[model samples]
Target: MKFRRWCRNCNCEQEVAPIMGYEDSWRKLFWLLEFLRTEETIAEATFDEYMEHLMFFGKLAFDADDEIEKRLKEEEVSDND
Candidate 1:
């Protein structure tokens, strides 16, 4: 599925972008998408892989913000324990 957030350069929130598909790719794609938002650079190979996944996954955009938030919180709690 895809996700979106505020984009400073565009001065508006972008349309949801499908970054990845499948359970396995979703986790890493979340972080990579965030990095792109902050104007961070990823390796060429990784970028190619993400784009390939995007095409292969077909059109599926989901607001995974809440899921990401929950996972992060769970990780924090486990870390403290």
Candidate 2:
């Protein structure tokens, strides 16, 4: 399925295609989430652990723009030297 993502450089939403060649991985993840949703005996600790992991990944995604900008600035400095 096609998705739309905000393009900071263009200041507009752009259509994005799913990354190629990861269908099996995506399917596995989908199945895992489905299982979790349907399972009635999930442990509290397991749910908390998964939440922590999700938050960590979310932080990485949110910080990506700043990381890219920092790297670009570092590259510029090195190029000048």
Candidate 3:
């Protein structure tokens, strides 16, 4: 059985074990980026902050996505049985 982390905000599936280490940071970063891209607001400081958070969680997010997919598959199998 495999476990994974799921990011509800981005619907990203990560393969790594769940860790709250940078969840908040990533969430804020994602929000900021979305706001900038959608609102066309130029907030340099916010952009910088968003990048910093992305750097911290970029790798984690990838891994977590994989794990999440694996877990979901397992759950489906269990439910079928």
Each model's number of backbone clashes? 0, 0, 15
lDDT of each: 0.56, 0.54, 0.57
Candidate 1: give its CA RMSD in angstroms.
Answer: 12.1
Q: What lDDT tens digits, residue by residue, belong to model 2 across residues 6-69?
A: 4436646665554442455444343344334334533233767666645654566558758898
Worst 10-residue stretch by lDDT in candidate 3?
35-44
lDDT tens string, model 1, 1-81?
556556647757665545344355555556455545445343333667667745443333344555787899999999999
Deviation (Å) of 8 in candidate 2: 36
Off by more than 4 A, model 2: 1-45, 71-81
lDDT tens string, model 3, 1-81? 333544548957655423333356466456444444333344434657657656656667667778999999999999999
Q: What TM-score, to 2 decimals, does candidate 2 have?
A: 0.32
As for candidate 1, its clashing pairs are none
Top candidate, metric TM-score: 3
Clashes of 3: 15
The stretch of ten residues in a row with the least summed lDDT in candidate 1 is 54-63
